[model samples]
Target: MALLKGWRYGVFISGIVGLIGLAIYPVVIDPMLHTDKYKEVQKHNRAGVNQEAIQPGNMKVWSDPFGRK
Candidate 1:
């Protein structure tokens, strides 16, 4: 195995620390601050309503066709 020296080792160590921070941020910090906002958004939405919101023509650019356009 090759050995790292000086600033190269610092860079390598910092990269590993950054990756660990990223993983922890989502699993810990994000949920604490954003969970309520997520639930509020979910209140107006539903799963398995895929033909519309989750798919094509559910967007505002499409015509509704039933005079709702």
Candidate 2:
């Protein structure tokens, strides 16, 4: 647009570049740099989920009280 010119154009272009970098950072850079750490965190999360899956209380969280599940 006419409003985007000179330094404004630089700012606009830089903003677009920043957005692209952000998208690529998560999808490409993170997997390349931190895949092992991410897998470890996922493993821990799954372990925690399985550990607390059968919550024991007056209100059951994941388990069926009548043993239907």
Candidate 3:
């Protein structure tokens, strides 16, 4: 029972640490690493453009010639 309790405690502590790291990352690491990318995204947003919008050339139209409807 002690071993099981220890394992559970370890898992709980590790989960808490992981959560803290995730919370810190966006506040600290993301701005430090991707500031330029964020700025470009903001610029596009201000210009009424969605960065995720697909371009025309990338569209795929599937035509099934061999499959029966």
- Best-matching candidate per TM-score: 2
TM-score of each: 0.48, 0.49, 0.45
Total clashes for model 3: 0
lDDT of 1 by residue, 8-68 (tens): 9999999999999998998888866787766666656644454455455545543322233
How accurate locally, in lDDT, is each candidate?
0.69, 0.70, 0.70
- lDDT for predicted candidate 2 compared with the true structure: 0.70
Clashes of each: 0, 0, 0
Q: How far is candidate 3 from the true structure (C-alpha RMSD, Å)?
A: 13.1
lDDT of 3 by residue, 28-49 (tens): 9997777777767766765865
Show the lowest summed lDDT stretch of 10 residues, model 3. Answer: 59-68
After superposition, which runs of candidate 3 have C-alpha atoms over 4 Å from their true positions? 1-4, 39-69
Descending-TM-score candidate ranking:
2, 1, 3
